[model samples]
Target: MTRIASCQCGQLSLTVEGEPALVSACNCTRCQKRSGSAFALSSRWNSNQVRDRSGKGLTYSRKGASGGNVLFEFCPVCGSTVSTSLELLPDVIGIPVGCFADPAFPAPKVAAWCESKLEWVRFPDGLLLLRDQTQPMDTR
Candidate 1:
Protein backbone atom coordinates (compact mmCIF):
# COMPACT_ATOMS: atom_id res chain seq x y z
CA MET A 1 0.00 0.00 0.00
CA THR A 2 1.22 3.51 -0.73
CA ARG A 3 1.73 6.01 2.08
CA ILE A 4 0.20 9.35 1.21
CA ALA A 5 0.41 12.87 2.70
CA SER A 6 -0.28 16.50 2.09
CA CYS A 7 0.65 19.96 3.26
CA GLN A 8 -1.50 21.68 5.87
CA CYS A 9 -3.45 23.63 3.25
CA GLY A 10 -3.63 20.69 0.84
CA GLN A 11 -1.83 22.59 -1.87
CA LEU A 12 0.76 19.88 -2.19
CA SER A 13 0.56 16.16 -1.63
CA LEU A 14 2.66 13.02 -2.02
CA THR A 15 2.42 9.26 -2.36
CA VAL A 16 5.02 6.64 -1.64
CA GLU A 17 4.87 2.88 -1.84
CA GLY A 18 6.91 2.34 1.31
CA GLU A 19 8.02 3.84 4.58
CA PRO A 20 11.06 6.10 4.90
CA ALA A 21 14.53 4.67 5.30
CA LEU A 22 15.19 6.90 8.30
CA VAL A 23 13.75 9.74 10.33
CA SER A 24 15.27 12.53 12.43
CA ALA A 25 14.94 15.94 13.99
CA CYS A 26 16.89 18.79 12.41
CA ASN A 27 17.76 21.74 14.66
CA CYS A 28 19.58 24.02 12.27
CA THR A 29 18.32 27.60 12.02
CA ARG A 30 17.00 27.05 8.51
CA CYS A 31 15.18 23.90 9.61
CA GLN A 32 13.68 25.85 12.49
CA LYS A 33 12.22 28.36 10.07
CA ARG A 34 11.10 25.67 7.66
CA SER A 35 9.46 23.75 10.48
CA GLY A 36 8.34 26.79 12.49
CA SER A 37 9.67 24.97 15.52
CA ALA A 38 12.85 24.29 17.43
CA PHE A 39 13.49 21.39 15.10
CA ALA A 40 12.04 19.76 12.01
CA LEU A 41 10.71 16.22 12.08
CA SER A 42 11.79 14.49 8.88
CA SER A 43 11.85 11.12 7.20
CA ARG A 44 13.80 9.74 4.28
CA TRP A 45 12.12 8.49 1.11
CA ASN A 46 13.49 7.20 -2.14
CA SER A 47 13.16 9.76 -4.91
CA ASN A 48 11.60 7.32 -7.34
CA GLN A 49 8.78 6.26 -5.02
CA VAL A 50 7.53 9.70 -4.05
CA ARG A 51 4.98 11.14 -6.43
CA ASP A 52 3.77 14.70 -6.53
CA ARG A 53 0.00 14.46 -6.55
CA SER A 54 -1.10 18.09 -6.27
CA GLY A 55 1.50 19.21 -8.77
CA LYS A 56 5.09 20.33 -8.34
CA GLY A 57 6.20 22.17 -5.20
CA LEU A 58 7.89 25.52 -4.66
CA THR A 59 11.45 25.66 -3.47
CA TYR A 60 14.14 27.83 -1.94
CA SER A 61 17.69 26.62 -2.10
CA ARG A 62 21.14 27.55 -0.81
CA LYS A 63 24.62 26.20 -0.41
CA GLY A 64 25.05 23.80 2.48
CA ALA A 65 28.07 22.94 4.63
CA SER A 66 28.87 20.18 2.22
CA GLY A 67 29.59 22.83 -0.38
CA GLY A 68 26.52 21.57 -2.15
CA ASN A 69 23.15 23.15 -2.68
CA VAL A 70 20.30 22.20 -0.34
CA LEU A 71 16.87 22.65 -1.83
CA PHE A 72 13.87 23.22 0.40
CA GLU A 73 10.51 22.28 -1.07
CA PHE A 74 7.20 23.57 0.25
CA CYS A 75 3.59 24.35 -0.45
CA PRO A 76 3.43 27.48 -2.57
CA VAL A 77 -0.04 28.41 -1.39
CA CYS A 78 0.29 27.69 2.34
CA GLY A 79 4.07 28.09 2.64
CA SER A 80 4.31 24.83 4.52
CA THR A 81 7.74 23.27 4.26
CA VAL A 82 7.55 19.73 2.96
CA SER A 83 10.84 18.25 1.90
CA THR A 84 14.51 18.88 1.13
CA SER A 85 17.06 17.46 -1.28
CA LEU A 86 20.79 17.81 -1.41
CA GLU A 87 22.46 18.66 -4.68
CA LEU A 88 24.57 15.56 -4.72
CA LEU A 89 21.87 13.14 -3.69
CA PRO A 90 19.05 13.80 -6.08
CA ASP A 91 17.85 10.20 -5.75
CA VAL A 92 17.06 10.60 -2.06
CA ILE A 93 14.48 12.92 -0.55
CA GLY A 94 13.92 14.00 3.00
CA ILE A 95 10.34 14.69 3.95
CA PRO A 96 8.88 16.47 6.94
CA VAL A 97 7.28 13.71 8.96
CA GLY A 98 4.49 15.97 10.21
CA CYS A 99 2.68 15.73 6.88
CA PHE A 100 1.67 12.16 7.58
CA ALA A 101 -2.02 11.46 8.36
CA ASP A 102 -0.98 9.18 11.14
CA PRO A 103 -0.19 11.43 14.06
CA ALA A 104 1.58 8.62 15.86
CA PHE A 105 4.46 7.60 13.63
CA PRO A 106 7.39 6.24 15.57
CA ALA A 107 9.87 8.66 17.11
CA PRO A 108 13.07 9.51 15.28
CA LYS A 109 15.77 6.93 15.61
CA VAL A 110 18.61 9.47 15.57
CA ALA A 111 19.20 13.18 15.38
CA ALA A 112 21.61 15.16 13.20
CA TRP A 113 23.44 18.44 13.72
CA CYS A 114 22.29 18.78 17.31
CA GLU A 115 24.93 21.30 18.36
CA SER A 116 22.61 23.94 16.99
CA LYS A 117 19.70 22.58 19.06
CA LEU A 118 17.72 25.01 21.16
CA GLU A 119 17.76 24.77 24.93
CA TRP A 120 14.03 24.06 25.27
CA VAL A 121 13.68 21.44 22.52
CA ARG A 122 13.41 17.95 23.94
CA PHE A 123 14.39 15.00 21.80
CA PRO A 124 12.81 11.57 22.00
CA ASP A 125 13.40 10.04 25.41
CA GLY A 126 16.46 7.79 25.64
CA LEU A 127 16.80 7.82 21.91
CA LEU A 128 20.15 7.65 20.14
CA LEU A 129 21.26 11.26 19.86
CA LEU A 130 23.87 13.03 17.72
CA ARG A 131 25.75 16.23 18.09
CA ASP A 132 26.65 15.75 14.46
CA GLN A 133 26.05 13.06 11.88
CA THR A 134 29.22 11.38 13.02
CA GLN A 135 27.68 10.06 16.21
CA PRO A 136 27.65 6.28 16.25
CA MET A 137 24.38 4.41 16.45
CA ASP A 138 23.48 0.98 17.85
CA THR A 139 26.10 -1.71 18.55
CA ARG A 140 27.63 -1.36 15.14
Candidate 2:
Protein backbone atom coordinates (compact mmCIF):
# COMPACT_ATOMS: atom_id res chain seq x y z
CA MET A 1 0.00 0.00 0.00
CA THR A 2 1.30 3.41 -0.96
CA ARG A 3 0.69 6.46 1.23
CA ILE A 4 1.13 10.03 0.01
CA ALA A 5 2.88 12.44 2.38
CA SER A 6 3.75 16.11 2.12
CA CYS A 7 5.65 18.81 3.90
CA GLN A 8 3.91 21.47 5.95
CA CYS A 9 3.79 23.86 2.98
CA GLY A 10 2.79 21.12 0.56
CA GLN A 11 5.40 22.39 -1.86
CA LEU A 12 7.18 19.08 -1.67
CA SER A 13 5.51 15.68 -1.60
CA LEU A 14 6.23 12.00 -1.96
CA THR A 15 4.54 8.63 -1.80
CA VAL A 16 5.79 5.83 0.47
CA GLU A 17 4.58 2.23 0.49
CA GLY A 18 3.41 -0.15 3.16
CA GLU A 19 3.96 -0.10 6.91
CA PRO A 20 7.35 1.16 8.08
CA ALA A 21 10.20 -1.29 8.71
CA LEU A 22 10.78 0.19 12.15
CA VAL A 23 9.04 2.98 13.98
CA SER A 24 11.27 4.49 16.60
CA ALA A 25 12.42 7.62 18.37
CA CYS A 26 15.95 9.04 18.40
CA ASN A 27 17.48 11.04 21.18
CA CYS A 28 20.90 11.60 19.60
CA THR A 29 22.32 15.09 19.60
CA ARG A 30 21.98 15.29 15.85
CA CYS A 31 18.34 14.22 15.98
CA GLN A 32 17.62 16.66 18.77
CA LYS A 33 19.30 19.47 16.87
CA ARG A 34 17.48 18.57 13.68
CA SER A 35 14.07 18.27 15.37
CA GLY A 36 14.34 20.89 18.08
CA SER A 37 12.44 18.59 20.42
CA ALA A 38 12.95 15.96 23.09
CA PHE A 39 13.09 13.24 20.46
CA ALA A 40 12.16 12.54 16.85
CA LEU A 41 9.97 9.73 15.55
CA SER A 42 10.99 7.84 12.42
CA SER A 43 9.20 5.31 10.26
CA ARG A 44 11.57 3.27 8.16
CA TRP A 45 10.43 1.99 4.78
CA ASN A 46 11.98 0.69 1.61
CA SER A 47 13.47 3.44 -0.57
CA ASN A 48 11.96 1.91 -3.69
CA GLN A 49 8.54 2.71 -2.26
CA VAL A 50 9.15 6.46 -2.35
CA ARG A 51 7.95 8.55 -5.28
CA ASP A 52 8.53 12.26 -5.49
CA ARG A 53 5.89 14.74 -6.63
CA SER A 54 7.49 18.18 -7.00
CA GLY A 55 10.84 16.67 -8.03
CA LYS A 56 12.33 19.64 -6.23
CA GLY A 57 12.79 18.59 -2.66
CA LEU A 58 15.96 19.84 -0.95
CA THR A 59 18.44 17.51 0.62
CA TYR A 60 21.05 18.05 3.29
CA SER A 61 23.73 15.42 3.26
CA ARG A 62 26.56 14.87 5.71
CA LYS A 63 29.03 12.14 6.51
CA GLY A 64 28.16 10.28 9.68
CA ALA A 65 30.81 9.73 12.29
CA SER A 66 29.89 6.06 12.17
CA GLY A 67 30.66 6.13 8.42
CA GLY A 68 28.50 6.47 5.29
CA ASN A 69 26.42 9.49 4.30
CA VAL A 70 23.19 10.66 5.88
CA LEU A 71 20.72 12.51 3.69
CA PHE A 72 17.83 14.53 4.97
CA GLU A 73 14.94 15.41 2.65
CA PHE A 74 12.79 18.44 3.21
CA CYS A 75 10.55 21.09 1.68
CA PRO A 76 12.18 24.33 0.64
CA VAL A 77 8.94 26.21 1.19
CA CYS A 78 8.25 25.26 4.80
CA GLY A 79 11.73 24.05 5.73
CA SER A 80 10.33 20.82 7.09
CA THR A 81 12.58 17.77 7.40
CA VAL A 82 10.32 15.23 5.79
CA SER A 83 12.26 12.08 5.01
CA THR A 84 15.74 10.70 5.33
CA SER A 85 17.93 8.10 3.65
CA LEU A 86 21.27 6.62 4.60
CA GLU A 87 23.87 4.75 2.61
CA LEU A 88 24.26 2.03 5.21
CA LEU A 89 20.53 1.45 5.42
CA PRO A 90 20.15 1.27 1.67
CA ASP A 91 16.82 -0.50 1.52
CA VAL A 92 15.11 1.77 4.03
CA ILE A 93 14.06 5.38 4.19
CA GLY A 94 13.11 7.08 7.41
CA ILE A 95 10.05 9.30 7.52
CA PRO A 96 9.21 11.55 10.39
CA VAL A 97 6.08 10.17 12.07
CA GLY A 98 4.99 13.72 12.81
CA CYS A 99 4.46 14.18 9.08
CA PHE A 100 1.98 11.35 8.75
CA ALA A 101 -0.96 13.88 8.86
CA ASP A 102 -2.90 11.38 10.92
CA PRO A 103 -2.35 11.99 14.60
CA ALA A 104 -3.94 8.69 15.52
CA PHE A 105 -1.02 6.70 14.12
CA PRO A 106 0.89 4.33 16.40
CA ALA A 107 4.05 5.20 18.28
CA PRO A 108 7.60 4.06 17.52
CA LYS A 109 8.84 0.58 18.40
CA VAL A 110 12.45 1.50 19.09
CA ALA A 111 14.28 4.30 20.81
CA ALA A 112 17.50 4.76 18.82
CA TRP A 113 20.81 6.13 20.04
CA CYS A 114 19.81 5.80 23.66
CA GLU A 115 23.39 6.36 24.72
CA SER A 116 22.77 9.97 23.92
CA LYS A 117 19.40 9.85 25.66
CA LEU A 118 19.01 12.55 28.26
CA GLU A 119 19.11 11.62 31.89
CA TRP A 120 15.50 12.67 32.43
CA VAL A 121 13.98 11.54 29.14
CA ARG A 122 11.40 8.76 29.33
CA PHE A 123 10.57 6.05 26.81
CA PRO A 124 7.33 4.29 25.95
CA ASP A 125 6.50 0.88 27.35
CA GLY A 126 7.42 -2.24 25.35
CA LEU A 127 9.79 -0.31 23.11
CA LEU A 128 13.38 -1.36 22.46
CA LEU A 129 16.13 1.03 23.42
CA LEU A 130 19.51 1.23 21.72
CA ARG A 131 22.62 2.97 22.92
CA ASP A 132 23.87 2.90 19.36
CA GLN A 133 22.35 1.85 16.10
CA THR A 134 24.40 -1.37 16.17
CA GLN A 135 23.36 -2.47 19.64
CA PRO A 136 21.46 -5.72 20.08
CA MET A 137 17.84 -5.65 21.14
CA ASP A 138 17.41 -5.83 24.89
CA THR A 139 14.32 -7.77 25.94
CA ARG A 140 14.44 -6.24 29.42
Candidate 3:
Protein backbone atom coordinates (compact mmCIF):
# COMPACT_ATOMS: atom_id res chain seq x y z
CA MET A 1 0.00 0.00 0.00
CA THR A 2 1.10 3.55 -0.67
CA ARG A 3 0.42 6.35 1.78
CA ILE A 4 0.83 10.07 1.34
CA ALA A 5 1.81 12.34 4.19
CA SER A 6 2.03 16.09 3.96
CA CYS A 7 2.78 19.14 5.98
CA GLN A 8 0.01 21.29 7.38
CA CYS A 9 0.34 23.88 4.61
CA GLY A 10 0.91 21.23 1.95
CA GLN A 11 4.30 22.73 1.21
CA LEU A 12 6.00 19.36 1.65
CA SER A 13 4.77 15.85 0.97
CA LEU A 14 6.10 12.33 1.20
CA THR A 15 4.93 9.14 -0.43
CA VAL A 16 5.59 6.07 1.63
CA GLU A 17 5.24 2.61 0.17
CA GLY A 18 4.02 -0.43 2.07
CA GLU A 19 3.76 -0.85 5.80
CA PRO A 20 6.37 0.58 8.10
CA ALA A 21 8.91 -1.69 9.70
CA LEU A 22 8.41 -0.05 13.05
CA VAL A 23 6.12 2.43 14.74
CA SER A 24 7.15 4.03 17.99
CA ALA A 25 6.19 6.70 20.50
CA CYS A 26 9.09 8.66 21.91
CA ASN A 27 8.80 10.51 25.18
CA CYS A 28 12.28 12.01 25.27
CA THR A 29 12.63 15.64 26.18
CA ARG A 30 13.65 16.56 22.67
CA CYS A 31 10.67 14.78 21.21
CA GLN A 32 8.30 16.46 23.65
CA LYS A 33 9.78 19.88 22.95
CA ARG A 34 9.91 19.41 19.20
CA SER A 35 6.38 18.10 18.95
CA GLY A 36 4.97 20.30 21.73
CA SER A 37 3.22 17.20 22.95
CA ALA A 38 3.71 14.53 25.55
CA PHE A 39 5.27 12.28 22.97
CA ALA A 40 5.98 12.02 19.26
CA LEU A 41 4.85 9.12 17.14
CA SER A 42 6.94 7.94 14.21
CA SER A 43 6.73 5.22 11.61
CA ARG A 44 10.03 3.98 10.30
CA TRP A 45 10.79 2.69 6.83
CA ASN A 46 13.79 2.05 4.68
CA SER A 47 14.78 4.93 2.45
CA ASN A 48 14.00 2.86 -0.60
CA GLN A 49 10.40 2.57 0.55
CA VAL A 50 9.93 6.31 0.29
CA ARG A 51 9.41 8.13 -3.00
CA ASP A 52 7.71 11.07 -4.63
CA ARG A 53 9.06 13.48 -2.07
CA SER A 54 8.01 16.94 -3.24
CA GLY A 55 8.41 20.55 -2.19
CA LYS A 56 11.20 22.32 -0.38
CA GLY A 57 11.68 22.10 3.33
CA LEU A 58 14.21 23.16 5.94
CA THR A 59 16.34 20.69 7.85
CA TYR A 60 17.16 20.82 11.51
CA SER A 61 19.84 18.57 12.93
CA ARG A 62 20.15 17.98 16.61
CA LYS A 63 21.73 15.56 19.00
CA GLY A 64 19.32 12.85 19.99
CA ALA A 65 18.96 11.58 23.53
CA SER A 66 21.24 8.73 22.59
CA GLY A 67 23.89 11.22 21.49
CA GLY A 68 23.25 10.45 17.85
CA ASN A 69 22.28 12.95 15.22
CA VAL A 70 18.62 13.19 14.35
CA LEU A 71 17.77 15.30 11.33
CA PHE A 72 14.28 16.70 11.00
CA GLU A 73 12.71 18.00 7.83
CA PHE A 74 9.94 20.50 8.20
CA CYS A 75 7.84 22.68 5.97
CA PRO A 76 9.28 26.15 6.15
CA VAL A 77 5.96 27.71 5.29
CA CYS A 78 3.91 26.12 8.04
CA GLY A 79 6.71 25.01 10.35
CA SER A 80 5.24 21.55 10.59
CA THR A 81 7.71 18.75 11.05
CA VAL A 82 7.20 16.26 8.26
CA SER A 83 9.88 13.59 8.63
CA THR A 84 13.08 12.65 10.31
CA SER A 85 16.30 10.76 9.60
CA LEU A 86 18.36 9.26 12.36
CA GLU A 87 22.08 8.83 12.23
CA LEU A 88 21.73 5.82 14.45
CA LEU A 89 19.57 4.14 11.90
CA PRO A 90 21.13 4.69 8.54
CA ASP A 91 19.06 4.58 5.36
CA VAL A 92 15.89 4.78 7.36
CA ILE A 93 13.33 7.55 7.44
CA GLY A 94 10.90 8.27 10.24
CA ILE A 95 7.66 9.96 9.32
CA PRO A 96 5.39 11.58 11.83
CA VAL A 97 2.41 9.24 12.16
CA GLY A 98 0.05 12.18 12.67
CA CYS A 99 0.95 13.56 9.26
CA PHE A 100 -1.01 10.76 7.64
CA ALA A 101 -4.12 11.77 9.60
CA ASP A 102 -5.41 8.25 9.35
CA PRO A 103 -7.26 7.10 12.40
CA ALA A 104 -7.06 3.55 11.12
CA PHE A 105 -3.30 3.62 11.06
CA PRO A 106 -1.70 1.14 13.39
CA ALA A 107 -0.80 2.37 16.83
CA PRO A 108 2.76 2.55 18.00
CA LYS A 109 3.98 -0.77 19.31
CA VAL A 110 7.06 0.53 21.03
CA ALA A 111 7.60 3.32 23.52
CA ALA A 112 10.98 4.96 23.97
CA TRP A 113 12.28 7.06 26.83
CA CYS A 114 9.55 5.89 29.11
CA GLU A 115 11.45 7.32 32.03
CA SER A 116 10.50 10.73 30.82
CA LYS A 117 6.94 9.89 29.97
CA LEU A 118 4.46 12.10 31.73
CA GLU A 119 2.68 10.64 34.72
CA TRP A 120 -0.69 11.12 33.05
CA VAL A 121 0.42 9.44 29.85
CA ARG A 122 -0.86 5.90 29.73
CA PHE A 123 0.37 3.50 27.11
CA PRO A 124 -1.73 0.70 25.82
CA ASP A 125 -1.30 -2.66 27.49
CA GLY A 126 1.33 -5.01 26.04
CA LEU A 127 3.39 -2.21 24.52
CA LEU A 128 7.14 -2.69 24.69
CA LEU A 129 8.37 0.18 26.82
CA LEU A 130 12.02 1.06 27.08
CA ARG A 131 13.48 3.32 29.64
CA ASP A 132 15.83 4.74 27.04
CA GLN A 133 17.31 4.05 23.62
CA THR A 134 19.87 1.70 25.11
CA GLN A 135 17.27 -1.01 25.45
CA PRO A 136 16.75 -3.32 22.51
CA MET A 137 13.81 -2.55 20.24
CA ASP A 138 11.21 -5.15 19.45
CA THR A 139 10.77 -4.61 15.73
CA ARG A 140 9.07 -7.92 15.22
TM-score of 2: 0.87
Estimate, for each residue in 1-140, the C-alpha lDDT of model 1 and write its tens digit: 57777788887888877778888887777778767788888888889878656656889999876578999888888887777898988899887888886776767888777778897766656667676665643422
Worst 10 residues of 3 by lDDT: 131-140
Clashing residue pairs in candidate 3 are none
Q: Pairing residues by index, what is the TM-score of model 1? A: 0.85
lDDT of 3 by residue, 1-140 (tens): 99999999888999999999999999998899999999999999899999789999999999887888999999999999999998989999999999998998988889999888898998888889888965844434
Supply the global lDDT for candidate 2.
Answer: 0.80
Kindly give the number of clashing pairs for every candidate: 0, 0, 0
Q: What is the lDDT of residue 63 in candidate 1?
A: 87
On TM-score, the candidate that comes out on top is 3
- Tens digit of per-residue lDDT, candidate 2, span 1-140: 66767788777777776777788888878889899898888888877777655546789998874789999989887899888889888888888887778676667878878878788988867787887876844645
User: Clash pairs of candidate 2?
Assistant: none
The superposed Cα distance between candidate 3 and the true structure at residue 112, in angstroms, equals 0.5
* Root-mean-square deviation per candidate: 3.0, 2.1, 3.1
- How does each model score on TM-score? 0.85, 0.87, 0.94
